[model samples]
Target: MQETIDLAAGPQHPNQFALLRQRRFAPFFWTQFAGAANDNLFKFAFTVMVTYQLSVGWLPPKMAGLVIGALFILPFLLFSATSGQLTDKWDKTRMFRFVKNLEIGIMLLAAWGFYAANVPVLLGCTFLMGLHSTLFGPVKFAYLPQVLRSSELTGGNGMVEMGTFVAILLGNVAGGLLVAVPEIGHLQVAIACVALAVVGRVVAQFIPSAPATDPGLVVNWNPVTETWRNLRLAHGNLVVFRSLLGISWMWFFGAVFLSQFPSFAKEVLHGDEQVASLLLVVFSIGIGTGSLLCEVLSRRHVEIGLVPLGAIGMSVFAIDLYFASRGLPPADGLHLLAFVSQPAHWRVIADLALLSLFAGLYSVPMYALIQMRSQPTHRARIIAANNILNALFMIASSVIAGALLGAGASIPQIFLCVGIANAVVAGYIFLLVPEYLLRFVAWMVSHIVYRFKVRGDEHIPVEGAAILACNHVSFVDAVLLMAASPRPIVFLMDHRIFRVPVLGWLFRLAKAIPIAPRAEDPVAYEAAFAAAAKVLQDGNLLGIFPEGGITRDGTLQPFKGGIMKILETAPVPVVPMALTNLWGSYFSRVEQGGAMVRPFRRGVFNRVGLNVGAAMTVAETTPEALRARVDTLLRART
Candidate 1:
């Protein structure tokens, strides 16, 4: 049982409005926006220049593609190891400003290259830009978990992704359009790149400086040794490692689709350079829409349940893209308007949109998982591992693409291959780490079982340790507590329940602490008390049912002395709660003889209530006194 509040103040809700107004996150957001804009700005300009301006004969498409891929790959390989170390050792905001300054220099070089029509210099700038991103990557990820609440992670990441992809799409379009302008030509593209870089720097200046959390840390700059070392640490956690792989695989799937656009547009769609541009637009827009939708769909919290759904969509839509482009007349420079008029092209458009939407849904949750799960001190190192895997997976994608394309596979077929591969990879990872799946099941069950409404939830302190005491009303009291509590809980449950069939497996998986009543098993009782105290001392939430067992008569039971013992030992704040109308549920063993309703026989769809009281300090609690207090709280609600 839980309580709910209607926070339906719409998109411009006061809380969201206050969040956006914050100095710390707002400027950081725009700095990323500018960085993404400039990255695609230069890439789009360089691609056009190489094909139209530099090529006197037929351009070696595969070779050009490989060079472009290398530019993106080199930074992650060469700099991210050092970058992660720097992020951990220094102030992230200050480091971000320095990275932005480096971007300014890179853009100036790109601007000159465009003006001189110097392809080599432009390529050099691309490599430099990638290096900047490499350095920024760890800091970008590690900074958010430090600044935002656990509940805010999903929405924050979604907003970042949305801003990034939207910027990429606009930059790609703007880059091409600027270069093509008759009065400015290629030089205008460079000019715009420099301007965006400057804008990025301006925003970076406004970003609130963050002091280093680990200032006494040693810095290691060796890419090969350190990168491998980082990956080793990240892989130590089986679930975290698998989540990283799932994320990397998504990038591989995305990169394959993005890299083949020019050829796909020219050969398959029979469209011009602008058509390739439009493909970029559609993909970016789809990703942006999907990214923003994550916050709304998840109700502003991280929900890994959506990951499976996204994987399913990615495979299905990608396969559709294969069939969508089949039997099309080859393209050879038809303009944008003409391309749109073609009825068959609409399938390609729809496939791209769905593919991107699913991709957005897929990637956001994995990021949140890493943030929530990774050890804080080693967070940057773990994120560094993510960057390394992303690079490797992306590089692998290029190799796979090259091999398949060389084997005479079509671009659409490659899309299908990557998409199907994503499904297989995602499924395997989730199967190995069933927590993601189990959480989804638990979340769904609680949501459907009753209309949970939380009130005065703000009284549940945000940080440090505390003890939560409520009546034992049902078998799933712990599960309901987990859903209602914002933080992860170290729950004390009966040893008997801990051995019960399928649910026993769940409790064990959750790492729940088991105890037997003193009368039943003295040793287990002692162990439970010790475990509960240790958890509170270590700064984790501890939930205990003061009632000790489920109510047999649908009336409040005497408060157990166990809670008082643990509280006195740990000296943490106590939060009292009352559960109403759950006595007839299947979990409650009611009416064995002369009790109220047969609680276990009350099927599904039973309405229940949970009312949370304000916190009580350790000094205010006594076994007798707290029992009276809880009795009064429950009586009022009843």
Candidate 2:
């Protein structure tokens, strides 16, 4: 029998770019890229044809655009529930091949539609293409978590997003240019679509098998009833459901921005196709760059902090974009070069780029969080519900945009309104779950307030139940640990700390267990121990300050028996860690008069270190032993 080595155990820190070199990730990435490119290619080609070429069957160009939009979105509304069920019930690899083959068939039909200039056939192909995407959506997302380790999820999703936007850019440019050719324009589009479809299928054949999440899941056929059931399943998990909302809101925001590109280019910039293409390229590149950066900024963890950061940037840049485009001059036939020749246009481009970069930062982590949090069995269905919500949000954006435009709002004004609305919606969601805000604060503090260096991080297990016994040096020790560790830790904190003003809310949001001294409050202490035990029993990491409070003298305090009591109940392995050089920091009491002070007492970017010792078996662990191990780690670092 071949021994299966755990990838998580093999490397403590794996770079995001490494996934691109692995078989499990590379092929699927290309397949998705090809598929996205083909979808946009056909859709863009048809839209261009409608706008410029043959007048079809009494429908105005604007009405035709709307009709095509409806056709594309109709399948998501009707077929996503069934598709989600299918993904859960069947092997994802096999289903992936089936979907790719379906795409080939759909593209063949699209080819003929393009060749014949047949409006009805093209519209039918659009609907079928949407159905193909609808079927692929759930599998595409849910498949990542199964194949990649927990740490790699963020990077994998980042690559996927980066590949997707790059593909979209290529497809739009190729489609628009190809369909504009004099005689063979339609044929050219047809051939490109068929060729890309074939390439996508070839890539799909190389994807390894992903076992069925729920092989016995009975496929639900009714769209309405199943859709309701799927929504209910999603609603059952508040965090997952809220993540779905965040993801959907991003789509709504994106659709509004993207849908305005052509019109905004023509009316505001007085530019032609080349200028529109330029805008598309800049936005796509920005998103791709930001997506790739998410893994770097997160340090290979799914940092939810980026979501709020992204949301804030999106609104800020979008508002700036509105202002930048205001009062622009008319340059009737301005091409890309001429537009770039002018200095004022640079601001518009900068706004779009920054807006897109933040959008990427906002989205990649949320997808990772959803995949990480959702139940494995019903993950696909939850993703399906997410897709449904995304479609609905996109549709709602269109409706709202139309209403605004009909009411005499220019495209830039609409952009401004969406930006303001984004702030309101994001604020509301953050209020509903302060975890997002708390995470942002932790991330910022670790990255901005203190420069944290970690050693022996490999000693910490990537999954399953474990107890982390550490000596807390400052108030922000938990935050530092959270930023360093790959998995979330349930910290056992003093109840008094939980009563402090702003920090209290943050600790509560992190779901920290609040313990009291046994002599002071026997009931609270017992409850805190019970909660700690439950956290470990659920196979999560529980962190406790074995000294029971922040160190006031920059030295390890004698260990308390609470650690032993919790270990006696849960009996999980204990990993001892130590924090060094945090004693005189702003949050520490080592400042003048032993009072906590802020604003760079240690100057900017003060060095702090966390050394994680090896895990100790429960049979050998005790208060004295664990404290000794942590002191040894601290001494070695010092």
The candidate maximizing TM-score is 2
TM-score of 1: 0.84
Give the per-residue lDDT digits (tens) of candidate 1, residues 581-620: 7676766666664322454465666666666778888888
**Relative to the true structure, how large is the alpha-carbon lDDT of every model?**
0.78, 0.89
TM-scores of the models, in the order given: 0.84, 0.95
Off by over 4 Å in 2: 1-14
* lDDT tens readout by residue for model 2, 375-411: 9999999999999999999999999999999999999
Task: Write down the worst ten-residue block by lDDT for model 2.
Answer: 1-10
